[model samples]
Target: MQRGLRSFIIIWIGQFASLFGSALTRFAITVWIYQKTGSATALTTGGFFAMAPTFLLLPIGGALADRLDRKKVMIAADLTGGLCTVFMLSLYLNGNLQIWHIYLTNVILSAVEAFQYPAFTAATAMIVPKEHFARVSGMRDLAGNASRIFAPLLAGALLAILDLSQFMIIDLITLSIALLTLTMVAIPKPTQTEESKRAQANLLQDVTYGFKFIWKRPSLVILQSILLTLNFLYTMGNMLIPAMILSRTNNNELILGSVQAVMSAGALAGGLLISIWGGSKRKIKTVLMAQVLTAIVGRVWFGLGYDTLSWLLPSFFVFFFIPISNGSTAAIWLAKTPPDVQGRVFATRRFAAQFCLPLSALLAGPLAERVFEPAMMPGGALASLFGNVLHTGVGAGISLMMLLSGIIGAAVSLLVYVIPLVWRVDEILPDHIAEPSSLIPEKTVDSDVGVKAPEGAASPAD
Candidate 1:
């Protein structure tokens, strides 16, 4: 293997372990919270707390990533996250663990992630060659999908045999593994440009520079707008999947779990495929087409299917395309944005795309419970209108919601694709050229400042 890709694989192994451990802890805590309170609202409230801080703090985190050593920033984030787990363990051992303590810990960890994500993303661009951006992104998605597939099952099995405190120790161990891997690798840093030098002058400007960067580029603005709209619409329907399944299946957890497992498996397969194929040459087209397919095949089928097989098929298809679309999008930005400014640019892109998630979370339940549910009930106001197509019943309203989201999402993606700016993004935005390393000698390279590779070392693409 090439040296750069080899180094990245080592890091990926540690990160995969860490991600699995975190997923296990999160699942265990979610079960514990629900069992103790028996209130979905209380459980959801903790999630809101966890997400709120990350949204608010991401720009600041991005700024820090740019100004600091990316490696050190990641190490600090891992250490803080590990400490949060330890704090929770201590509380549980002392019999003082409350729902509030979990919420507090969630908030802290979310904040740490705000910093960690940007640094890691920026570092990946630094070390990997441009040709392999999509492949690496697919690999990252693979880790996440693998965690989703296994974490819940493993956590449940362990919980049956061990206490939550003991389970949490595993998380700490994973964090140490991540830290060790990070310490061993060297990440290249971007050579400073005039734009970066000016950005460094003011903290506030650094935070906002990402926004300005995108705004100046119409193609990027359109891309972000498309993603933002899709996220808002998708989240509105996506969050209701569990409710729809449970209600339709008469609260059968087995069917629900089976469907979820299939979905994760599909995503895992897609990620693995993309990692090998590296996506299509026209990444922008790949991204848009994937969304269209996801909406038409996945969401539309989900709303129409009533049986277990029906749900499983659509769920798998939806998740499978998601990784392809996401990997393509990451590759687009990685190539277009200069490495020195990627931390901020990428963070802003994420913040904009996901800004509506919490809003959708708030609205989806109320819309389903009050408006859609009532309207879809037999002989209800809108039942006669949509009844013939949707089959008015327990989850029929949510089915309608899903159907509508899919239609709208598909239409929006197509509409955006037709726009010249978005359709021709690749042609409009030129790729950033990598600076030659001859200017900075290997003997003088500093880890904090950044290193291009040691002399004679091969990069990922090579």
Candidate 2:
């Protein structure tokens, strides 16, 4: 590998360590919440708590990222997240833990992450060459997918075999190591321009400027909106999956963990495939195909029930497309946007995509429990509508929803595709707008900073 690429790899490894640790604790916390409360709502609290804060703070975070040194922003975010974990771990270890505690800490960490994301994404654009963007995104997602496979399984086993508090301490240690490793790396930051150095503008207005930028870009807006819709469905399915599995297998941990691992493993493989193949030359084709695959698997997986060997077939097919889709979508963003404006643009992108998660979680459980599930059950009310083809059962019901979702998704995809205006990811959006990195310059204190990779170390494209 070239020197820049090698540095990017090293930096990415440090991030992987951080991701693994975070995943470990996250799994522990999620399980602890669910097992303690036995409420689906309780179980998904982390999802809301961890994400809502970031959604709320997107505008500020996006603007800050544009003004600051990306490396400094990321390193600080990591250190802050680690410290938050340390404190939370201690509180739990001392025998004082509550649902509110988890919620509050999640919000804090997530707010920090709000800053971390845009900076890291924008930094990648600056550091990595265009050709390697796809592979780098795949590699980044591969690390996350690898963690998803192992972290839950490990957490499930660890929680079973060891004290939650003790295992949590291990996570704390990992965070410290991640922060320390980051301190050793160097990532170049862009020099400040005159406009970047001028008197500070209103934070809200700067953010509004970003809004205008995206509003003017039809392709970016449509893609973001479509992703929002798709993720809405995806999260809905996810909410119901645990309940369905629990019904079938008497809520077996091994089954749950194994299934999760299998799906993530499939996604990991997809990431690798995309890393190698990059994606379709006509990016719109890749997106539509991914959507079609989603609709197919979403419709089929639920129908398969818990068929030990066969159940994974559709799940694998669907999941294998996710990384390719996600990475390809990211590549479109990276390629289309310039290095300067990406921070704000992508921050909005992330924000819009996740903004509805809380609402989805809030509504999906009840809908499935009282509405969809009952309708799908044998001889139930809605069975009359779907009774002939779908049949009545948890699997059948979920299948109906999936099929419907897929059909809707396909419709949505094609609508945007043929419109021509929204088909191009790059046509409307402006490239990254250059800005000074002095707003949050690198700190003088070396110990406080994470690894600072030399400037211009190129990362592999996905």
Candidate 3:
């Protein structure tokens, strides 16, 4: 097996273990918040608390990834996050648990995550060969999806039987395993001297430079816009998904868990398929059309008011595309980024992509509960138009939102295509831009090995 492939498996297993524990905890926390406060706003606040700090710190984290050793950065994040859990677990065990404790924990964890996502992603380029990029991406998704499938049911059962404090111990064990995996593997670190030199400017200037890097690169910018809009739609659907189920069904835990499993099953299948089938020749389509469309299809299903497992059969197929889309994009970034700069570039990318997630948490709950649900529930405004195609109700109204979101996303994709500059984004990158060494061959020795030399720089022999 390829070294990258071997390393990928080791890392994936660790992340998979960590994810299972995380999923269970997420479900438990959400339920805990709701049960304690009985307010949607409070729950939204909790979600915001978890993500906002991370988003704000992404630029700083990007700089760190660019300047520091990524392996150390990752280990530090794991350790910091794990320690927070230890404290939370201790508090919960002592019957001193408060919602404030969870909020504070989220903030610290988010700060740590700012480092973890980019480091792990950028490292993949060093370990995996270009040929296996998509497969590696697929396998990564498989680990996460597998966790989603098992975490809920396991968590729900455990939470029902065990105390939340005990659950923390389980989480502690899983995170410890993830950290162990980090210890087991040796990640290759390319020299970052040039990257460090370029980043000598002030923090604001550094962040501005990152934006400029993308602003000048049409492909990356366009892709970011698509992702932004896609995230909004995704968040909207995600916000409503639970509310949709909760409104119609009595069983909260089972509905949430089983539905999650259903979608995760789709992602698992998609990841497996991508692992085998790879993706379309136009890798962008895998991000935009193939896998994204699959995710959108499930949104349409939810909007359509189909709850029974038989009725939700199509969701399985739609769910399959998410990991494929994510994996395909991962391949694109890994393949295109120069190793030295990847730490910064990918960190910014993570920062930008995630910036909107917290916004979604803020907007989704209110929109679903107040605006969309009310407008479309029990003879509301859009009900008649929706009724023309399907039954008129809150569920139907939300379905309209899903269908419209997909259409809007499609239009956005077409508009992006027309921007011609977007298609040539790779061309607009800096002269020094180098592809990851694992993905390409570059003769000159530089800190960021992947960067293409200035137009005239001759090969080493020259």
All-Cα superposition RMSD per candidate:
5.3, 5.3, 7.2
lDDT, candidate 3, 1-462, per-residue tens: 654466567777788787777777777877677667655556666777777887788777776766677777777777787799889888887889899888899889878777776666666677667767778777777777777777766776776787777667777788878777765555456655465566567766765566666665667776776677666666566555554554455446666677767767777887788788777655666666653464446555545554656335654654567767676676677666666666667767766665787887787677666776667765787677666664655455556666676666556656655676554443444334333334434333222111100000000000
Distance from true location, Cα of 238 in model 2, Å: 2.2
- Measured with C-alpha atoms, the lDDT of residue 375 in candidate 3 is 71
lDDT of each structure?
Answer: 0.74, 0.64, 0.64
Task: Point out the worst 10-residue segment of candidate 1 by lDDT.
Answer: 453-462
Report the error of model 3 at residue 37, Å: 3.8
- Worst lDDT 10-window in candidate 2: 453-462
Arrange candidates by lDDT, descending. Answer: 1, 2, 3
Off by over 4 Å in 3: 192-205, 387-400, 423-462
Tens-place lDDT per residue, model 2, 1-462, is 644456467666765665666667766666677667765556555566766787788777878888877667877876676677777778887889888888888889778877877777777655556766677777767767776678767776776777667766776676666666665655456544443444237887778656776687776777777778877766666655555555445656666666666767777787788778888876656766776666566435544444445455565554667777777777778776666666787788777766787666666666666777778887888888877776577555555655566666667666666766666555545444433222233452122123322111011111
For candidate 2, give the lDDT of residue 219. 69
Off by over 4 Å in 2: 191-200, 298-310, 377-379, 383-403, 426-462
Tell me model 3's lDDT, rounded to 2 decimals. Answer: 0.64
lDDT of 3 at 6: 64
